[model samples]
Target chain A: MLKKERQALIIKQINLHNKVLSSDLSLTLNVSEDTVRRDLHELAQENKIIKVHGGALSKSYNVTSQQSDTYAYEEKNIIALKTISLIKEGMTILTSGGTTMRAIARALPSNLKATFITMSPLIALELIEHPNLEVILLGGKLSNDSKISVGGEVVNRINEIKADLCILGINGLDFDGITDSDWEIVQVKKAIINASRVVIASTISEKLNSALRLKVCNLKEVDYLITELPSDSPTLLAFKEKVNHIL
Target chain B: MLKKERQALIIKQINLHNKVLSSDLSLTLNVSEDTVRRDLHELAQENKIIKVHGGALSKSYNVTSQQSDTYAYEEKNIIALKTISLIKEGMTILTSGGTTMRAIARALPSNLKATFITMSPLIALELIEHPNLEVILLGGKLSNDSKISVGGEVVNRINEIKADLCILGINGLDFDGITDSDWEIVQVKKAIINASRVVIASTISEKLNSALRLKVCNLKEVDYLITELPSDSPTLLAFKEKVNHIL
Candidate 1:
């Protein structure tokens, strides 16, 4: 195959599979791993894909480029559907910023009357058309990559509100606790933990064993942990043992 | 000339001059304004340039884009240099998010002692290595376009602190007041205005006489308005008349 054709094939594979290992692509394309790596680097430079630790992932899968709402659509939809089960009319809720939270915002039924206090611009935009829902955006310094607010101001504002429920989108969670990738994010999460009456974490199964740089709260702080997979999964069981509840 | 060459030439002209009139481009190119408009439209489609009310402006000149820091480097440097002059040792200062502010953050003297509070992740990242600076990042919803935090939580945090100075980057300013293009941004700016003892606005001359969707604070609320040009400039004079001070 021509060099352009092979590169195009690699891109197609990444788009199809969400991620591709360099070695795998090398073998598939009948090229050396070094050549595949070079192609991936060039493609990444073109913003066609993202170079991960050992491979390439579709840039579209990353939430920072576009609105976070566009990523993990199915997972977010399932998480949102599961999350809405915990909501009740007239309840005041605090939702954090993430693709999952954005999905929940979009999936919220218009008939469900509730007050939402959020630190996500995408959420505010999503909730703008909802007449029955009152959305209060927590203002602070913006993080361009995450499209979420983080800083002391966001934390202080979260502290002032007493929410019936807080639906947190976990960056990473292990048996020990909920963790965040950024130190600034931890500050906001800490405030959310202090203000909410019931803390609910909406995360995917993949994030169970992962831990990031900052620790927000212990698993004990979470009232419930919801994931798309079945409740009997080992990760869920481990989390259930540490936290108060699981969904 | 070929269509692509003509389009490239127009784009080059706009980048070279900063602004160009459609009629002038038409006359210079010996083509009708309608053809120039079509070429501009095509270039805009390819993200080569942006179509303004009258003619095209170089996308390279857009300060909000990912590579915006590269363009307008001289103007941003001057603004940063002037802005840093306002900072003093041990004073707590609030800075809004923008390429201009980011430049200011970069230009800050490493030995200067101050508590720098902001919602811009880029600024926070830049300040991490500053030994003498205490960086407090305000948390809230993040806006991807501007990479600034906004919303209630961020606002509440701002209200809790009384900063010595607040340095703001104006989106659009008019005879009436300072306006933001986004609704949530207005809330964030209002919080910033209320939290600081002195409000300083840093903007270019062209930003004046324009209004955006969200109103932050009126010119009267500002303690000082700083621009690149002298205070006697027509736009600055208009702004100076509405406010108590100019820098």
Candidate 2:
């Protein structure tokens, strides 16, 4: 099994029993004890679990809980909160998978009706709780870390879809260009941008001046920028000239 | 034995008996006491269980807050359990949308690698949890009650592929024929039956000798009929004569 698959199962087991032994996980996942231990260690680093001696215990809330349990960072929460206002009822959306996008999924009202097309399996699960919403999960080879779909199949599927807006997550952004580290992610993001009428980049201000190896798009391509900082913040002045709207 | 398997056993033992010794595990799993001790130590770190003097304590292990709301009817559970034997590791199965099919989706092993074609959006979400399972959701106009897809698009999609088995959930069944209440449902069920080699009808024994307004298929066409009652029961004898197999 893939590492992401193993990790997802581990998270599921921990949430159910609230505690899991490394030995038990090894047995259930049909993996080596050492691999289970490494998974526990990584989850611990992500603040999703606390590594104990014989087994691991889940964090305060289940990892699967939509909004409250995960994405508690101050700035990400601020960006997530502001992005909700941009999405109106009955709009079709294309969302890339990331922590910030997850926040938006959690904050969505249960009664709201909308169509959401996403490549991330984890994000699809998070958004599946909305009773009135329609969730379309694009299938392809699953990426281990980002937990999103990548490769040619995903791009082909996205090409056939056109949405009202695309909510994108970025690795870094600057006057030079918006960038992401992973090549496959850059490809998928580019398709998402093309499939939607408008592109909204969801990010914190800390990523403003940094640049990654791959250029995703130019600054002028972004229709709206949602951030925690006020629209009039001096830090956003340079961003304003390149984007149509900043919130 | 893998360390994770050993650790899982230890946790299970503790849950069942309230405590377990490291020496006992080493003897049972053919591992060293030091390894068992290390496992216990790690589980303790996560607060999943308490590393006691010789073994471990339950340590909030019984708190099953993470459990999804399932396991409602004993009859449904029995049918779901029996259906597992029919599925192979890599077989593609077409699952009809309903409560009983959801149970089968929930019971699928995490390691089982198979393609599941489901028309229900809700079942798609449930089956998506299995890491190795490839879910092909047949999207079309949604039915409010069953939450499965209906109409021309769904029929067109199912016509293009053949599956090893089709797990059908019925509203009613009788010696005369299998039936459903909705016209669209009957149409979809007919297409699903045509798209698979094997047809397995899952129902409570109470639904026997009952007929709804619309006909799905004849009793002679059913490959398997699964219910809560024993196969030898006179209640199922009539069904046995028509179906290819029963359990």
Candidate 3:
């Protein structure tokens, strides 16, 4: 089989069985253990799976398949509250689409007079109820899974706007930058980075060391990284040392 | 063959031949001339073909299988101009996804100050260049075919917002109300209607008297219906008598 096909099969196997050993993958694909480990590492970088001492595990399977509404509601709500606290009236902000961003949208004070620009349909609906806020939607090819805009057209649009702040949701983050598994999403995130003056990323602790196939930006691109955990947490500290700020 | 399928086949033949007499199609499809004329008339109602003297000719063959970006451009532009004229500085507007609405977005003046809420990625991008406008996008299931947001989540979000104006794109407009071909789209339109104080519909003359599978709202639901043709046109007169203001 082609390498792409083999890698697809490996991902499928891991998805089905919840884990896969190097030995099993090597034998199944007629490759060496070293090769299998390399494949596992690549997939790990994509944040598609977690590489353990022996094998790989699914990365927060609960949120991977369901809508953002089904994911960690409490943690997302907390992060959202914290993110919204940074906003002042009459500011322009850019945001991505996800449960986390949706939470932040819901958390916005109804009386705040900020102008919000985003690619999430859910956020647009939320902003309409807020009489004081103005909402702008970015247009592009819509992803069936994320229900957000992601494509060349969206990227082009993002280049035209300059926002005071950008609230981002990361699937994974590390010394390298915020990462996502989908290629099209990577393009969208890049656009978000270019449009915003200050970049604030919200992610959980487990995603610290993880990487994904698409790199949205490097550590320098983000001005602040927000998490539900305290600043003293080991993982949070580790991430802070690699990046600029931890909130 | 089923009636719809047979009609589709007759339409295809007419498209291929450019013009087909009733007797000609009746011979080819092995149907009576009466049935042939009926099929032609039905397709004509959909604006899929145009009946001529003693025969029928295909509507401009520009509409391909893939999505056509060319639907009602001049008319849509006029409607867009009228729609954008309704927006005052600092007003919040709700918009649905379609080529017509996208045109309205493109027509927005750079100096115009407002907040735009929509489910279309393209509209969001267009609004970005207007420094005075804010954009908000609604998140939901994305339909690849239309490149727009749809589904229950989008509907729920629309329920949460109340906007000053709602600009809608229509597949067809009959005496009963605005109509769409897709059931999910109709659902989203319903939500948009409930969330906005005033509803303005931008449709072309061809959409008059046409009915799709999904119904959006009754004629009273929309405050203004804008079309390309003159208000004195026979079709427009017929429509105005049944509906509200026709622009």
The top-ranked prediction according to lDDT is 2
Candidate 3 per-residue lDDT, tens place, A89-121, comes to 889998888777877887778789988877775
Q: Decide which is better by TM-score, 1 or 3.
A: 1
In model 1, where do residues sit more than 4 Å from their true spots?
A: A1-92, A95-160, A169-198, A202-223, A227-247, B1-51, B54-74, B97-99, B106-112, B118-132, B136-162, B171-199, B209-225, B229-247
True lDDT of residue B56, candidate 2: 82
Tens digits of per-residue lDDT for model 2, B170-202:
889998879999999898999999999999998
lDDT of 3 at A181: 90
- Provide backbone clash counts, one per model: 29, 24, 25
Q: Scored by CA lDDT, what does every candidate get?
A: 0.76, 0.80, 0.75
Separate DockQ for every predicted complex:
0.10, 0.10, 0.02
Q: If candidate 3 were superposed on the true structure by all CA atoms, what would the RMSD be? A: 19.2
DockQ of candidate 1 is 0.10
Better of 1 and 3 by lDDT: 1
Interface RMSD of 3: 16.5
Alpha carbon deviation, residue B175, candidate 2 (Å): 3.1
